[model samples]
Target chain A: MCESIPKTMKAIVFHGPHDVSTEIRETPKIEKADDVILKVKYSGLCGTDLHSYRGHIKGPVDQIIGHEFLGEIVAKGSDISDSEFKIGDDVLSTFTIQCGICWYCKHGYSGQCDKTNTFGKVGLPGGQAEYVRIPYAKSTLIKKPASQDHADDSVYVLMADIFITGYYGVKKIVDFLGQKPAVGVQQLEIKDATILQYMVLAPLGVGPVGLCALRVLNHLGFKKVVCVDNVPSRLEEAKRLGAYKTINFETEPTLLKEVIEKDTGNVGFDAVLEVVGASAALKTAYDSVRRNGFISSLGMGHEPLPFNGLDCYLKNINISFGRCHVWSLFPEALEIFETLKGDFASFIDHKVSLDESKEAFELFDQHKVSKVVFDLTL
Target chain B: MCESIPKTMKAIVFHGPHDVSTEIRETPKIEKADDVILKVKYSGLCGTDLHSYRGHIKGPVDQIIGHEFLGEIVAKGSDISDSEFKIGDDVLSTFTIQCGICWYCKHGYSGQCDKTNTFGKVGLPGGQAEYVRIPYAKSTLIKKPASQDHADDSVYVLMADIFITGYYGVKKIVDFLGQKPAVGVQQLEIKDATILQYMVLAPLGVGPVGLCALRVLNHLGFKKVVCVDNVPSRLEEAKRLGAYKTINFETEPTLLKEVIEKDTGNVGFDAVLEVVGASAALKTAYDSVRRNGFISSLGMGHEPLPFNGLDCYLKNINISFGRCHVWSLFPEALEIFETLKGDFASFIDHKVSLDESKEAFELFDQHKVSKVVFDLTL
Candidate 1:
């Protein structure tokens, strides 16, 4: 099945901190009974990839460094079931491969599964190469929707990480606000009222994830969406993408909380999406939310959060934070992407060939681009 | 109506820290047009009352030092319609007087209303007296159900604070664990599965609130409830009240997380009800919850909570902490109290006349009694 594929292919490899290069490497093959080979089509550079590149997230030397990709299956192992997924299928694989039978996976928390492993991190090969091997192919590979344009395919690539993550963050916020008692007859009505009253939301840190969250929240019919960021370009993009208001943190001498309070008539936002993963950003979210509000944190900060438990207690805040279990939201995300119909394409400010991935990373790290997609076809 | 009632009454007044005395004070009258006067019957002592007594919670020097009470309406203002409540009606007033027309009151968060005021707190006169004034009578006073007796009335006294607070804590934990997606067909099934799989609950601190929480959890069909505290008598009381396991922290050298993990087969409790306001108890609750578990904090700590935000994020834990909006759960709590019969009366380890209230306060502050009730009939 792999006869037509080359043994050696071009791949972007992570060598060490501040080091990445396009190198010729042996193409991955079906290594296990459940493994399948994928001919990579498109890959997206994420914040975590930047973290890995900067050595903040340590990994093996000479490791392939990308996780978000859509690809066509080229080969399959002997034990693979062609009935469920066959050769030549266009698919998008989640970064986290869940066993599907683990306790966490069964409970809809696939990201925390005991057998879960991520691509481009410590244990598995990444999707930035010409060809990659995917384990647990049946459960991990989601067949791409039959929308064959590059723009549509770019949306699918986002479904592998940031878009789903952003969606999950917003979903959590809505859930927190709309949570109702288990035994109330008026639960449905209460939930509806909660959502209606809590239409105002703020997405902090207008990076790819935050922008996507803004898009998702707007798409969900939230009328009052505020975008906060220090970067002018990102804020502009956020404004273009339906932020009711934008706050440039760099220009504003006032605190973010004060700005939000002023905009929200001192009621504060019903929810804050903290996507920067810094304590300051989280604190802003905490301060900007009204009593009985939510802070949905999507950022991965390594530092111990500066938390005032008393403040959280007094405010009655509900905070939901963790990695996005992409597979859990995969079906809905694909449907949303289809409905969006190229709206998400505006987020991709830069596109580069795999050869220019190093430059792309540097530009992304410096906040020169909102999102950078690697056109593997190039 | 005014001629029959006395112009003055004996009330427990707070002069300063550790300076509480029974004094003859001017009797409360119908200050608001919607107010009603009640002849105080039974009043319950609470941890917050102790805070006010110790000056940890600031109040007027002559502020009354009680909030939880049940009584019979003696007089009513002209605006109070006798349709829902009338003179001589047995009733219990929530600690919070919710206007019911405010945004928070109408939205089911009456405790957070702009016009909400707590009895025995800064702005509201308390019920630890011969007679008490209740504002927003129609919304604030809950008519006692037909099944009336002194024992049942004592349980109703709990509804004004600890029992309702305890019930609210458990409700929050259940809501956090059983949280469903805002948009999904399988929400009901998912919620059921979540509750079934996550039946193990731990209530930290076997105080009156914690004991009430245990009783509520047990009544809710949770089979594996663990009670943790340092007091042997309280632990024994917890065991008597339906705790599946008990962990006395004073005698146990092992960490709470280790003990819980061992008890739960290396999987921690699905939810923790933290009734002690101390940071150590909060930390223990945080450490003992499983991944994606919930910690419902009911305690009010003066100091900032010792928090590790990274740990919370990585664990994917859901923490809901706040003062109990007791009025929010008033209806359900009343129903539950009725079904509980006199079962909750065991928590009242001491009952004294109004004259012996000083000794009762000392005993409660020293943890020599689980709960103290003022029998106004004496």
Candidate 2:
């Protein structure tokens, strides 16, 4: 396993706030019984990665930083069973390491496992590199579905986090709507087509996360989903991806009235997807949802949510807030990616070599680019 | 149809805050063709009634004031199907009027229906009377289940609101746990008995609502439930109702430490049932829940919930807030009542005559009594 490996490989290293560079580093090896060394194929930029770039999450300087990675395993540990996984198997990983035996891991709470560790921070060098060591690889890395074998690996990088996250929130909304996907095909068909009376709000104008959610919503036979943002171009992008309506909340002084009075006949929406992670946007979601409605919010905001218990109770609002747990829903997201690979790739407008880590982060920070992926093959 | 009924009857009339009196009033008649007259049997005094008494919810003063009622249909509208419900059938009424034709009612959101009006407020006389007019009788009232007909009518009164509320919140917990009941019996059994490592917190020491929830939790075969309160008597009551652990937060200097370190071994509870509608209690629920845990909060509070968006995001918390819609879960509550009628009635320490309206309200307001019901037969 070590004979053919290089002594040094290029990795995007985080030096400080607004400081990231592709630097030569010694290749990682399989150090543990369950560890596997993955040859990184493609890795995408994410909001959490930006948190490091902007200094909001502060110094873990000189470490490789990216959690969304899809790749092929080049080496495996002795304890790793070959039947479940083998060397050269193509795979995708969750944002964090998971010890499969923990209470959280066994119960489908992959994000909060007892032995969980994020790949990019706290001393774990992430996949913005040529080769990465994955501990607990048997549990952490899922095989690339045969259905998506031919799909672009960049598209599957979305599966590592954003696509699954988008899918997670949409699945929750389906639960809220009481919509059950058909047993075999597993496409959520709203029981009554007339249930189009129920509307959903997804912020598809910001990032790939919301657009991916929009894509799943349309695939589920929903016809009353709305997307909102200030940018006309993003709103147009959302509309192109099957958003039923769009609101430029920046320009519309009557955003609430329009959504409530025009779109939903004054009852407001049945569910809202909050991906903006801002109090103002959360307020809009709260204000637009009808009594007994639910909000599936995955936005990672640092601000306090603007909500009072009495206000929520009075309207009978239901809200589920969290980051997506990426284990169970991985295959489902891959299944989705098989059909909408190009549509998902449309959001990833920037694909560059690891050397452009500085430019990519800068462009993403300025909102000049919506999504970026490092082509490690480059 | 109501020829045998008396012209005048005893009623509890709210003249002002802290001023309720038993007075003889003209018996209610079927004023609308959609109305049905119910001969009140048992009427529960609720926390909302205290809201009126304490002038918190300034009311339609001088009106009959009770929403939780069990009764016999004395007379009914011509449109009310005699085949479905003949005169003299025992029935239970939801706390509010529900018009079945509305989208809310059709979709099981009976609490927020198009024609939702609380029975005790806004000029509609509630069930604190010998005879009460029930509008939307076809949809508002449900027949007493044959199983619970022989049980205490007061326990069935619990079904009208609190029992169902407790059940609603618990059902959400079941959803959160991803525990599905058996297809036939519909009792949520944890897939693995060892999964009891997941804990739940229900404030069973506060009121009949929490105890009623505790009853449902145990019936579902859940083994680990903790109850918290300052009162020793309430904690004892909770223990009697099958709480596995009780924490008196007031006396415990290390309340969070005890629950986190000792009870759950440092990971917090898997779910929290929030029925105490105060900021402090909500904070406790927020603190005690583990990452990826859910808080099924039905607590209606006036103050802002003490939480920041970032903290909730970091914890990956899931919270659902609402008043329970009583229509769909009524039969399920009756099923629980069939088994736990005595246990539910154990919490209702006050059973008084209609003439004792003032006494019952005073006792409940002062916390001298846990639950009170007007026994019309007295």
Off by over 4 Å in 1: A54-60, A148-152, A181-197, A252-265, B16-18, B52-60, B148-152, B181-197, B253-265
| Model 2 lDDT per residue over A71-100, tens place | 988899999888867988998888888787
| Weakest 10 consecutive residues of candidate 2 chain A by summed lDDT | A180-189
For model 2, what share of native contacts is present?
0.53
Residue-wise C-alpha lDDT for candidate 1, range A143-259, written one tens digit per residue: 887765655476567878888888888888767766663322122245445343454556888877888888888888776788888888888888988888788878974755575
lDDT by residue for model 2 over B35-114, one digit each (tens)? 99999999989887887799887877888889999899999888888875789999989888877766566656677778
lDDT of 1 at A30: 75
